[model samples]
Target: MTGPTELPVPDTVDVRSGPEVSDQLLSLLPLLGEWHGEGVMTGTAAGSAQDVRFGQWMRFSHDGRGFLAYESRTWRLTDEGRIVGPDVRETGFWRPRGDDDVELLTASPEGLVEIYVGRARTTTSWELTSDVVARTPDAADVTRAVRLYGLVEGALMYAIDRAGADDPLRPTMSARLERLR
Candidate 1:
């Protein structure tokens, strides 16, 4: 005759908190809208004097989780007005990491692994540094890049500084973006 049976309990228990989202991530709602910008990229296979027209659009969405997913598409044109080989698309996630920092995780087909830390500078400005890792060995890579985004003269302006390169005088890219709203 069976006297008694014991049920074993699992080691871990799942807890639900009805979508715990961060306030910092919610502040990025304004960036969700459409943005148009024109810029030029130099230091390609061509010489430094070559110019290209650039246009980019960034969008943000949520997937019922605490993280906000973002995608950015950019196109480059030749100096003679010819389309480049392919458009660049970067897919990533933005989420609050700690008290005063945000984390950005992204992956690209060009063997780019990116992780950025965001810090708020002012009410409408922020600074970010992306740690980039290359999947290939021969790529001229940068360990990290410091980027500042702010409004100057009613136009969106950005500056980038790349560090951890083999060369100290490596060329950097800088552009000013006018908000085409």
Candidate 2:
């Protein structure tokens, strides 16, 4: 992708009394809704081969703004497909830098904060590489990460890979979520 360019300002911009979406956010409009689905998480956790089925609920909404607000909650599932308990939660914002470039700012309850920068491969897809990864003193030693998101068959699909001080980049998690709104 090309370097960032100055985005054009609208002739007039003002707050609306009711919900409204901005043209700058139209590229990501497909994700402006709630999504729910289930998948599996497989990797090394707690020094063991961590493998588990899970369910997730994700939401992307805007308040007459230029960026989309994002939040996700996941739950562990029993072998019989029952939700056993809460697993992980994340909060973030998907900010479009221009027509192509975008930035993702996210934090995990697990004490990790990540910033990813990349371009929108398409109106419905993005491939991002971590520009900065920060961790709390008590967090895991994550050093690198990559993420991909796209709309496949009308479903939101995403995958993530990560590496730590002692490991190479490897698959962390992936899932397909169906829009609920």
Candidate 3:
């Protein structure tokens, strides 16, 4: 896995106000708060059930350029709340394109560089597709993932798709998460 790198500074002149960021980006802001949900990760090798809690916070600033600077920290709960996974920190930039689109660039140790194209679907919902690529030597063995984000009833819902194996067929795992404030 890779670690964070110092991002190249941008060249610019504006600090405040163009068109307020896209609704798609705004819709994701609420997710900045704490979120607790149960996640089940199952694979061909083994499976386990455990309580999962994730916390996140995001801040947007200006780097003198037209881009909105963004950074966030995520924490995973473990050991009856006594332990936590390595704090997953994500730093990136967001920029609103035309009237309905926004672009997000991010990197993580998972050896992934992601470019997310977000489109507003409605007043309370939006959709985003991430183009992800692995940067490691064993990248060929990794599969691509497509994620869908939407609100069901009043809860946040997510779905993922991965390249399926050619061998014996089996159902893929999918999950739904409700906001627990």
C-alpha RMSD between model 1 and the true structure: 11.1
Clashes of each: 0, 0, 0
Q: Say which prediction, candidate 2 or candidate 3, comes out ahead on lDDT.
A: 2
TM-score order, best first, reads 2, 1, 3
Q: Pull out the clashing pairs in model 3.
A: none
Off by over 4 Å in 2: 1-18, 45-50
Sorted on lDDT, best first, the list reads: 2, 1, 3
Residue 41 miss distance in model 3 (angstroms): 6.9
User: Taking the tens digit of each residue's C-alpha lDDT, what string does model 1 give over 50-136?
Assistant: 645666665555534556776767777676656675555678886766554667787666666678788756645668787554545
Residues 1-181 of candidate 2: C-alpha lDDT, one tens digit per residue:
7855753432112233335677888677777788999877774642336677789999887777788888999998877999899987999998988888888999998999999999889889999999999999998789999999999999999988889988999878788999887
Model 2 RMSD in Å is 9.0
lDDT of each: 0.57, 0.83, 0.48
Tens-digit lDDT string for candidate 3 (64-122): 44455655455554546544664445577766566657676766564546677776566
